[model samples]
Target: MTYCVGMLLDKGLVLMSDTRTNSGVDNISVFRKMHTWSIAGERVITILTAGNLATTQAVISQLEERNKAPSDRRPSIMEAPTMFQVATQVGRLLRDVIEGRQDGGMQGEGPRFTASMIVAGQIRDMEPRLFLIYPEGNFIEASYDTPFFQIGETKYGRPILLRGYDRRMTFEDAVKLLMVSFDSTLAANLSVGLPFDLQVLERDRFDPLHSRRILASDPYFHQISSGWSEALRQAFHSLPSYSFAEDSTPSDGAR
Candidate 1:
């Protein structure tokens, strides 16, 4: 399992993905799940992958190959005319890879070779876009009604994003919100671990405004994890206490 979030903000896009992957407790390893491609002043594309490692790696490798040697054989994401087309090509490739692998494997386990991705980026004049691509080769773009996308180990951290996300928030605050979300997930799931990859792509800029690999020993993340835990404890304590006596229900404000 993994945890990857792509937040669509008015400023641009913010993405983070955990690096942990494992076949079992003793077989854990770290590999980057976040991949990005940019053409200086033309476009920027970032993908956050989750699920079967082989399936995801194959899809990424094909994309990189296409970029390095463009042709009609396969449409390179870098050459896709629009962000929508870039997402379409990636989704198609992901679906094909999974299906192709399954054809060579045993029955009743097609899902084990499946994967999904979050595609976020912008082309020259268009507004930045965010998409969630499924293993079936279909996708939906983020909108005001749904302003963010999360894949894998999503349950533990989803509530934080739901309650805290705001389109008008600053980039700094957005990253802070993501840290809290990732921290909560980290505490709840062993499959999702440290050294998260983070990126910020400002609107209209074909290059990343900020890019970083946050290690377990990173000071800022350490503070966010510890402080968020303490804040939750304090908030719990501050809530109105319950009473045992009959006819002692708390007031509406307390409720």
Candidate 2:
């Protein structure tokens, strides 16, 4: 399991993903789930993946190979004229890999050979875009009403994003918001351990504005995690308390 979030903000795009994968309690490993491709001043694409590791890896490998040797059947991501086309290509590739596995005796009824991705980037003069590509080769784009997309171990962290996301928030605030979401997820799930890869793509830059790996001991993430816990505790206490007087036995006299 993993957690990956991509936010489409007025200022730009923010993407973050954990690097944890585990098959069982005794077999745990860390593998980066974030991948990026860019042509400076022309285009930049970021992909965050979750689900069946083999399936995702195969899809990425094929995409990378196609980029190096473009064929008529498989167009390179770099050749896509728009971000939408790039997403279409990725979705097709992902579906192809999963379906191929299903054809080769892998069960299709469950998560076996299934994977999903969050795709975000910009093309030259086009507006930045974000998408969530499902295992079925279908996808949905981020919009004003839903300015962000999260994949993998999503439930534990969704509430924070629901209450905090704003389309007009600055890039800094957007990254902080995502960090809170990731922190909430990490506290609840061992399969979603850190460190995390983060990327910021400023609008129309056609390249990453900032990118880095956040380690377990990262000071800012630590502050965010502890601060959120304290804030939640304070908020819980500040809320109106329930009154028990009506339900009480009226002091054994007024009843």
Candidate 3:
């Protein structure tokens, strides 16, 4: 499993994803789940994926092939007139890959394949946007009420975004928010691990403002995880407690 979030804010866009893949306690590995594409100042996009690894990989590979093709026949993400069209192309590609794999195997189970993606970015003249693409190739955009999208093992990290995220937050604050969110997820689920990929795109830049691969021992992440844990513990203790009076036969002494 994986954990990824794409957040849209008034300042810009923040994309984050963990790289861990776990099948069991002993079966563990790391593979990058975040991918990006750009055309200098014309357009930029990022995609974070979850669900069956094989299916996701194949879909991405197919997309890459088209991009690598010579001349104008490459079916353009870079040249798409609008961000919406780019998303449509990606959605259609995802659906094709899923269908091709599932139907290619003629049997009852048909080689089970399902995947979802969080896509975010902007074109030269368009506003930054975030989308959560479902396994069915449909997607929903992030809105003011909910300015973020998460994919895979999201429950544990969702609350932090829900509580603290705001449209006007700075790009710096957005990264911290994502780190705390990932921190909560790391504690509750073993499938999502560290060595995360993070990117921040300032609005209208049409490029990544900052990008980093956070390792297992990265100091900033370590600080965020530890600090958030301590804060949670402190908050829990500070809350007023409801205690049942000790069950005792005190009346017997009076009798």
Candidate 4:
């Protein structure tokens, strides 16, 4: 399992994905799940994938190949005219890759072949957009009512996002929120480990404004994790204490 989140904010887009993949306790490995493509001042695309490694890798490889050699193939993500088209192309490719594998030799209902992705980017002169693409090739875009997308190991960290996300929040606040979310998830799940890939794109920049990897021992991440834990403790203690009515007298027969 993996954890990836993409947020569509008024400022631009924020994305983060963990780099851990595991088949068992002893078979864990680190594999980056974030991929990006940018044409300097023209456009920028970032994909955060989760699920079957082979399926996601195949989808990414196909996209790269198409972009490198567009003559005999359909439009690649880099060539898509709009963010919507980019999501469409990626969804189609992901579905095709999974279905092709199932048809080739794997069982039809094998869960290991399933994968999902969060597609986000900005096209020249167009607003930034975010999409969560399912394994079936269908996707949903982010809106004010739902301005973020999460894939894999999502349960543990969703509460923080639900209560804290703001469409107008700054990129700095957004990244902090994401770090808290990822930290919460990491604390509860062994499948999701550290060394997260993070990217931030400012509106109209047509390129990433910030990008970096957060390692397990990174000072900032450690500070955020510890600070969040202390804050939560303080908040919990500050809440109104529960009260119960005191018994006025002993039971009639107990005295």
Candidate 5:
């Protein structure tokens, strides 16, 4: 399992993904789930993946190979005219990879090789866009109604995003928001362990404004985790206390 978020903000895209994979408690491992490609000043693309690691890796490897030696028959994301086209290409590739695996005898009652991805980025002269690509090659875009996408181990961290996301928030605030979300997830799920990868892409830049790995030793993330816990406790206590007396007047039902 993993956790990855691609947020659409007025400033551009903010993306993060955890680096943990485990078949069992004793067989845990770390693997990067974030992948990016760019053409300097022309375009920049980022993908956050979740699900079957083998399927995800195969999809990413094919994209990398295309980028390295793009041909007319096998076009690269860098050549895609728009962010939408780029997303379409990625979705198709991801679907093809998973289907190929299923055809190779990894089907029936065994573990299904499926995966999902969040594709976010911008092309020259176009606004940044965000997409959630599923194993079936279908996808949806982030819009005013849904300005973000989350894949993998999402339930634990979704509430934080629901309450805190803002379209006009600063990049600094966005990262802080994601940290709290990831921290909540990490506390609850063993399969989503960190050393998270983060990237902030400013509008029209065609390159990442900030990129780094948040390791276990990262002081800021530690602070965010502990501080958020304390804050939640304080907020819970501060809310109006539940009063049994207020609920003791159920005369209609009792009668």
Candidate 6:
């Protein structure tokens, strides 16, 4: 249904999410899958969503409403004291919305309320942190052994990250690796399409360093896609050739 990745590096954080929603072969549309809340020079938080659109929207809407109310409610993400508390609030809200909607009181066959999110950011006095929240309200943080998180149609694009990802890599290299990873996923999954959203938050800056939307017609994305495909082809062709000159198997080889 989507492709969202949150990569934690020594430098900061890189988050990207596709903007495609597909219900059937003939039903397709674009909806932004990334949302950010930031108080420049104070704190920043980004959320990437995947799964049932209604459920995700409702959860976000509820949070936004709470933030806009009479100022007596809990602080919004922009005012949160810690990234962990922000994530905790969001996870609880998501679970409550899904469970409330699934009680089957409104009508028969209640609308599917399944969704997950990747949340990342840094508080003014804390280090950058990244988290992946599951549909059930539980979450896990990025660790040294696995410094990245992915949700939705992730299998296709995951291999590149597995081979190239490292906490020591620079921000520029991390962006390139993610572009390839997203490119691979785009090529293989119909449910995930472009108009990608990316955000980079440098460590301890308490602000976003870079944020942009990449459209389907963007030249850089096209170049990355084409270049990666060509590189793969060349690598395949360069592999050592193993041929049987006499059409007879070697004694050490399987018969």
| Among all candidates shown, the one with the greatest lDDT | 1
Best-fitting candidate, scored by TM-score:
1
Cα deviation of 34, candidate 2, in Å: 0.8
RMSD list, candidates in order: 1.7, 4.2, 5.2, 4.9, 4.1, 3.6
- Each candidate's TM vs. the true structure? 0.96, 0.93, 0.91, 0.95, 0.94, 0.90
Task: Write the candidate numbers in order of decreasing lDDT.
Answer: 1, 4, 5, 2, 6, 3
Cα lDDT of model 5 by residue, 26-141, tens digit:
88898999998877888899999999888899999999888888654797887889889988999999988888877877787234688999999999888999999988999999
Clashes of each: 0, 0, 0, 0, 0, 0
Per-residue C-alpha lDDT of model 4 across residues 1-255, encoded as one tens digit per residue: 899999989889999999999987789999999999999999999999999999999999999999899796588888888999999999999999988888887875667799999999999888899999999999999998999999999999999999989999999999999999999999999999989999999998987899999998899999999999999998877766544548543333311
* lDDT (Cα, tens digit) per residue for candidate 2, span 120-232: 99998789999999999999999988988989999999998999988888888888998999999999988999899999999988889999999999999999999999999
lDDT of 3 by residue, 1-255 (tens): 899999989998999999997666788889999999987787788989998888889878877887887474767676678877777878888888888777876346533577899888898877888888877788888888878889999898987789999888988899999999998999999899989999998888887999999999999999988888899888866766544558632332111
Give lDDT: candidate 4, residue 107: 71
Instruction: Give the poorly placed runs of model 1, Cα more than 4 Å off.
Output: 251-255
- Scanning candidate 1 in windows of ten residues, the lowest lDDT window is 246-255
Which one wins by TM-score: 1 or 4? 1
Q: 2 in model 6: Cα distance from truth in Å?
A: 0.5
Model 6 is weakest, by summed lDDT over 10 consecutive residues, at 246-255
Off by over 4 Å in 2: 71-73, 108-110, 247-255
Local lDDT at 160 for model 1:
89
Candidate 6, 24: how far from true, in Å?
Answer: 1.9
Candidate order by TM-score, decreasing, is 1, 4, 5, 2, 3, 6
